[model samples]
Target: MPRLPYLSGVAAATAVVALLAAAPPPSGEVTVSRPRVVAHFDFAQGQTPENIALEPDGSADLTFSAARQIAHVTKQGHTRIRATLPAEANPRTPVVGDDIVLGIARAHDGTLYVTYATGTRKTGVWRVAPGGAPRQIAQLPSNGLPNAIGLDERRGVLYVADSVLGTVWSVPQQGGTPTEWAKDTALDPVPGSEGGFGVGANGLKVHDGAVWVSNSDRGTLLRIPVRRNGSAGPIETRATGLGGIDDFAFTGRGDTVLAAMFLDNELALVRPDGTHTVVLTQEDGLSNPTSVAVRHRTVYVTSGAFFTMRDPNLLLADLGERHDR
Candidate 1:
């Protein structure tokens, strides 16, 4: 773990932008009263980050599509390439989307699970073990396209949200056929906007006993209750009106759900009451943020330039930055 002096979170936030102005390369960590830009990367010109996950030990893993790679960012700010996902294996799956990762998660045993789809071969899921090569874990039916991945640490099950198929399927964490947990055709893409199945849902996380799914096109966060048998309850919409929700994570011990709105590039906090607070806005310098994770009161958001047209960079905000308290 990279150790930096623990300044008051406030002090760290205030110094970040000032420090950025004085530097050539971005300094890795930024501390603020609450919101600080701890790390920033310029998406290698063409490539952009899709998702970001903080390792239990405090390091971060980021996935980039245009660059065809995944990188591990140390707590101290150093980034090292971890893997080059075989985009060459299949072309159907996007290289990256709105900074949403190819899908990165850690199993209970600290094994990293990364999932990406190829446009060519839509039936397969890739499993890459730590210090090992990538292997094909399962090949689904012809029409199945695996989008986002989530892990049920206790049960050793992996949840896949396939927007293309309008379904959420759970596979054994070790790898196998996926059982449908929930599905809604309403989420496919609208006829004019982007075009697709209408529902743009993916980016899944298992919290408490429920699997929270981000419906990007409909702009809502859903909680699919996972029973003991791993089947699901009626799909419950947890919060709505988020602009194009993509992916999100729990914050501060998992009390609040911090969701990233892909269209608006906003980070919205969903309280238990189903109400939301706009924690970060594009005006705060976020553009197409796809995934969000909270570590020790700090919110780490990853965003892409959006396709080949937008500016791609990762934004770190100290959650307390805007709080005067």
Candidate 2:
């Protein structure tokens, strides 16, 4: 028998909650049948919200470089100042490009991991305690430039996508040497184009014993089975032709995945069978989206005016019952 994709429904609610907290609530208040725009925030005007991470409690957290701060946005739209990166962490590291926290991951114990790259000169991982300061975990090897970070809730492994070498490394969440778990070539079939090799792995996640990566250059999503010991199995392609694909998130539904296509200016809803359709397109409110997160049926996205810039926007998308479709 073929592998079955996970589907979201009332029956899966428990699993969804156990897997991912509410993280962020739907931007819209009223419930609808299909996905719709709920709330919008523009960073270009100084509201700088960079990478977003959702908690199981329906709350959202955003990293802001302008104020050198991290904020927690509640389900009710209330924003709180969580903590500020000390000048010493030097979030403004010359090489880190003003955007150190390009990716964020939270473990089941509530430990938060942030990835930073500073101008090919220096780059390291930071682990944020529940109520303590962010401490350096491990420095990226000279050949590695951390672009994306993902957590394996089951094995206590942290997955980092290196843009410099287009490879993925599995590091112990507790901190230690990392191993090459998988590569982007899994999705790229053409010679010199395996999963757009050499283009850098931009986004990644390990779900249900499988690893998924965003090959932004090739506009494809790559998946491969992951071993508990941090080894990787054969690779496979999940979805493709996603113009300017930036990031992806599961809708708590097994077979469903939502992808953010920056260039296309739309959110592509994908099924496990490799079929997808645009469920939400850029309307009057969204502009240059770069990341996505889902809570319940609500989808939260971060938009920016330019890539690798301090300017960004926070746009909420309501998936409602359409998630069932």
Query: Which residue segments of model 2 deviate by more than 4 Å?
Result: 1-50, 65-69, 84-99, 120-122, 184-199, 307-311, 322-325
Please provide, for model 1 over 35-142, each residue's C-alpha lDDT reduced to its tens digit, 9 standing for 90 to 100.
444556664543467777678877787777456467887656677788775545334443222212266777655577765555444345566677876676765444
Write model 2 residue lDDT over 2-121, tens digit each, in one string.
000121121123211111233332342222234433434444433455467888897887665445456777766677777665443432333233434566787767777876554333
TM-scores, all candidates, are 0.78, 0.75
Candidate 1, RMSD to the unseen true structure: 10.2
Candidate 2 Cα lDDT to native: 0.60
